[model samples]
Target: MSYENKILQMKKLLKKNNTQHVIEKEPILKPDVPNYAGIWQDAGLKMIENDFGVVFLLEKHYPLDYKHGAIYLRELYDAFGKWQQTQNAHPISLTDANNLIFYDTETTGLKGVGTHIFLNGLLEESEDGFTLKQYVLADPSNEVAFLFESKFWQGRKTIITYNGKSFDWPQLQTRWTLNKKDLPPLKEHDHLDLFHGSKRIWKNDIARMKLTQVEEEKLGFTRLDDVPGYLAPIIYLDAVKSGQPDALLKVLQHNEWDLLSLLTLYVQATNLLCEGIAEESATTYTNIGKWYADLREIDRSEELLQQVTNQYTREEAVNAYYHLGFQQKKQQNYIEARKSFQQALPYLQGRQQIIALIELAKIFEHRDKNYEFALEMTKQALKLVTESSLWTKESKTLRLADIQKRKNRLERKK
Candidate 1:
């Protein structure tokens, strides 16, 4: 019989065995037929089976002494407790590093029906050092199995991801719904999405706030000859169709590096925020100061802002002085506040300078009762606002009117 006739005969036999069996079985390639497990094993991936289906897993161990950039894996373990307390969620003390999981996923697309996660990467501290485990969906059919067998999510309190809150978690939830499976307990975990923190701390300092960009520029780590993330889905699909493990190996490597980078980024960010890494740039210090100010950590904010003021002589440092002055003024440290505002003047220009002058005017008039000095500062601010092109006519007029009123009040007091 011809090949087409034989295929038809096999379909008929399958229908006769179960007429309701309309689902076509995925074909195993010629190489895969002889040794199904050897295909993944040869690629250094181990096959694991569960109730739902089979998943390929790869595990790597890095020693405590292993350093990525400036941080040791052990330092990351040490910093998690402090980092957890600073997040917006209610503090759940994560002292044991084993309970913390750094997770990331590579999906087919950004969102909606067609997209599926092909790989899930997780990093956690182990007895020796750090262990990175990657669960690969060798076949799309095994995705449910992969999700079910993800024992790492069970009994773990904290999960750290770069942008997992908005993108990764939501995609997983969608996948669970599509598969008619319940969402994992990871939802209840103390999830820390580093994207928000990264933006708050490094937005001004970095060229771009992307994870890769942060890894390269801020953390001093870069991937060598790694596959770009955008090409991940394409490579994964080709691997699945062709039953070839080569492309999938690259995907796994890319994902493993991503997880490692996330661990390093987390450590670096925490160190900058909590332990205070020395020799940081002016903008980095200023951004951290602003972050602390937002958190109402007044002492930390002052310390970081002071560092920016003392170590740098640039436009960014002027903003730091302004923030420092504002914090000091809030604490009623009028002398230090006045000095900070004064120091900020030479570095500022246009609207910023005008604003600083107005602040100084207020301090002079209200706190020091130096009415003549206050009047002089107000007059200087009014002149700058009226002459400067930075402000709109209406804005300038309102500011000029406010400064003029201040000048009038100072004159009356004098």
Candidate 2:
């Protein structure tokens, strides 16, 4: 069926028989997404009626995240996969998908030096109006730990942050550690860091990889009047000192739009990724090779891999060759495996170097019975490894021991 039809079907399944559900459904048919304020109006009303606290709508003149550009869907999926084993919900059918926390913090200093955590602004939803909780540093010992230390972050598993992976995660980890508190095992949580992720995808056209640019260009998000982040410290300080909450409100709104922009980004990225791999000639050939290899369909894998051999990059060519080598090895085709490994050896370096070396060693030792050469390769592997790797030390130790035993047997025969 058509893509829109699939979306409609998924929407139908997810559509709840409630006012909020109907409201959410109405927007899907719109010609274009309404402005940021329009979204706040609808979501805010529901929040207010349910006694959710007032949604702080802050606007920032500068982009929230200046690093990282647009990200590809597949790249995001891979990153998310590293953190989470599975998604809570499928891409199109997002019903019952737990809400995400789109968070950003404006700190006293960017260097992360010293013990100066000046302010943390968080925009979250409640049954009442939407709430923007600003943790202020009234004194040197101001602890914003309670905001994150609570069970609020426990239930939900997905965290969508602009540059959380690099800046926010480390800072928060340090803060939690300082408090002698346990963080909520966020490594297992699906973290979508838009900064690096976006950079990977949109590094070509988007000159500035800032959140503000993506908001304006991609999501059509704009704020008429907003305070810049450079002035956030001043604004927040004044609001705290004189009991003037208006200046602080603008910062809150800036954070609030950040939260919404993150959501829109998720929606957009998911839509793009869910469209499946791009069908360009080169991309199609590479993906077909990937798909078949993943499924262990060696014949089909080899066919596609060969087709894409000269067309794609060296990395893709290496990957395809490795899989072909693996399939041939499994079939006891040692000569073919060696040929494939030779093709792949040019691309092997660093971590991949050790892996390819070990594989070649195994072929010599187990299949070819070239114990002397195998022992040399294993020694090379041992020399290259400095830390824990995908292959365990115990496994390497056993392999080395076995190779030693083989060498002894060969020596006895000699």
Candidate 3:
């Protein structure tokens, strides 16, 4: 079947399967299945009630020095403070831990309106440790009560997540929009999605950037017998249909690990951004330096990239020098930019080499008023492009035309 058609059927099943205000499935489990409220409470989930419906809630607290998967939860505080000072101390009050929400959600499906979050895991800090609250949608009918009573995020100042900026939070907003009544605005707050930072630091090193993979490979955390996320939809649906939540326990554990990982990854990421963060590989420095440059943290960017150029490998130095030069050129630091481009020349070839030559040529021509040097650089790039086999037929034609024009202009001025 087409993907869209399957989604339509799934939506129907989700809406129809809820026994309240919808058609019901014949009980999938034997009559011996424990009562829903009884099972949940026995499993450490409290029965939470509101005007809309009933939801299940579970809370666990961890002391400051408690280590989960190689990270101490308390270290995040200092890391955030350093970053806050860099942002001019924007009063986030992260030390309070009440200000930040380490959040994640487990959904019924990956996309579309059919997706409903069955579990919402939020972790915050207290005086000594961290508190995690997992809100459970006991049934589809209880979604409103679950979302509303999972405390509505009244005073939190920041929302931290793995990919919540693009997925989880947006999904929440969509749920609010669809439900469309008596809901607190899924309130706006400062957001630091660690997924982006993880990519900035580990894009080249990690084969996959999934949160679990990142924590395992980069943060030295591993889960033994952890439930895979893909099973969440099926497990949740079965529990709801069969009135059996035994399997859902593993799912909850999976989510708990996710929340803790976000907390640790954020600290490491901030540490990297602020104080070089534990001697990362040269490529990490190169990538994050370029990221900082893009964020206009030029000095910090230069500091990281500087480490890369001083490293032993020529292959490593090429990307670092190119980006450092580009950032410097953007700031009109022409001399430094020229030095960076020249330093990259020994390690570059093909398009990157030609591009660097052209950039240097432009700086000499316009900034230094050295027409002869400009013409020389342009001539070298033109010759290289003319004989290069890298470009496609159409691209080669375009390159030759542009380079010839540049060479002609430089020759006339020289």
Candidate 4:
């Protein structure tokens, strides 16, 4: 018989074989199975409700619409912006064991507000790549491997996840909350979310940095004959209802690939930061400097900052100058740091102009004891703040407070 005829035969047998309580198998209609059809909803509802609550219905496939995918991409972009602002404070690197955990998840849907996650996969480095322990809910009752109640995660340190900050972590936490189950103490486990990391390093380089694309490009791994991601939940439900536990192989493979891809992405991102091209190297140094600063390793932070300053282009040079100045100021080396800020003064404008003026004020007020010069610098900063409509309320308030406080201090000195 033809493939379509065999599939029809299998469907007929499946329809009759699957009852409310018993899982029956019809004889194999063909040596090889047919491609997956749109019977996932039928399988899922039956498994979930223990009754055939829904029937199979196939809608026209619209794989390229991507309206929801676009939203996800934009969300990732905004997340990258946030990471860029703070990456210097918490840089994503493979070396920081006290600051990393590999996290992955298997979910029924994408929306966190209402979607459900059927499995939570947490991985750690093993001999080869990563040892994954997938916490799955096999039936409605039995804990697949007793994962949810396992004490293995009790005091573990960090969670390194892709988009976990926004999605996976929150989803898992919400699931635990709903179950009223004790969640392993996670607050202490600092998160290094890799989605932002990947975007930061690859946004301009790759057309799409989706996990599949990254796996193909970076790791040279590709899926062959794999089930589509959207169909995973359907397959899982089908396997459950029919007790054809073997049907879960595809979904299991998908989940495993997701877990491994997260690791591969992490490694690739770290490698890029460590060994990138010239301009990219400068960006990496700047980002690494910020991460060290966040970790309170001022020496490492200063060294990385110096790397950026040494090889920086005009734009990078300006940012490097500002950061080096701030780092020196933090270390109480006002004289040298003042020179760094002054170096950028020619190109610095707007907010940067305001910041430079404030630093100069600090030099005169505290170091030089030149209160008159300090007062002049503060006045210039205040003027700039007034001129800029984009100045934040907090910025205006802080500037006014600093200027007035200096004025009072100067009065006392005089």
CA RMSD of each candidate after superposition: 10.8, 17.7, 11.0, 17.6
Off by over 4 Å in 3: 1-34, 84-96, 182-185, 330-335, 363-380, 383-398, 409-414
Error of 3 at 63 (Å): 0.7
Q: Where does model 1 exceed 4 Å of error?
A: 1-38, 78-94, 181-187, 314-316, 349-351, 383-401, 407-414
TM-score for each predicted model, relative to the true structure: 0.81, 0.43, 0.81, 0.54
Output the number of the lDDT-best candidate. 3
Q: Write candidate 4's Cα lDDT for 285-323 as tens digits.
A: 666566557678787678767777777775656666777
lDDT of 2 by residue, 1-414 (tens): 999999998787666545355443222111222123243344331111111112222322223232223433223334344225433233222322345455677655555445345445554433322344544443233343333332344665556688888886667666656644323443345666877645543444467878888777665667658778678777755654564566666766676667666655765544433333343334344444555455565565566666656566766567667766777788889988877776887786666667676788778777787767666666666666644355578886775576456445545533
The order of the candidates by lDDT, greatest first, is 3, 1, 4, 2
- Overall local distance difference test of candidate 2: 0.55
lDDT of 1 by residue, 153-247 (tens): 36746788888999987887777777653334444567888888888777667878777788888888887888998999999888777767898
Query: How does model 4 score by TM-score?
Result: 0.54
Predicted candidate 3 versus true structure: per-residue lDDT over 286-403, tens digit per residue = 8878787777767878888988888637677688999889988988899999999988977887889999999999999999999999998988998998899998989999988998
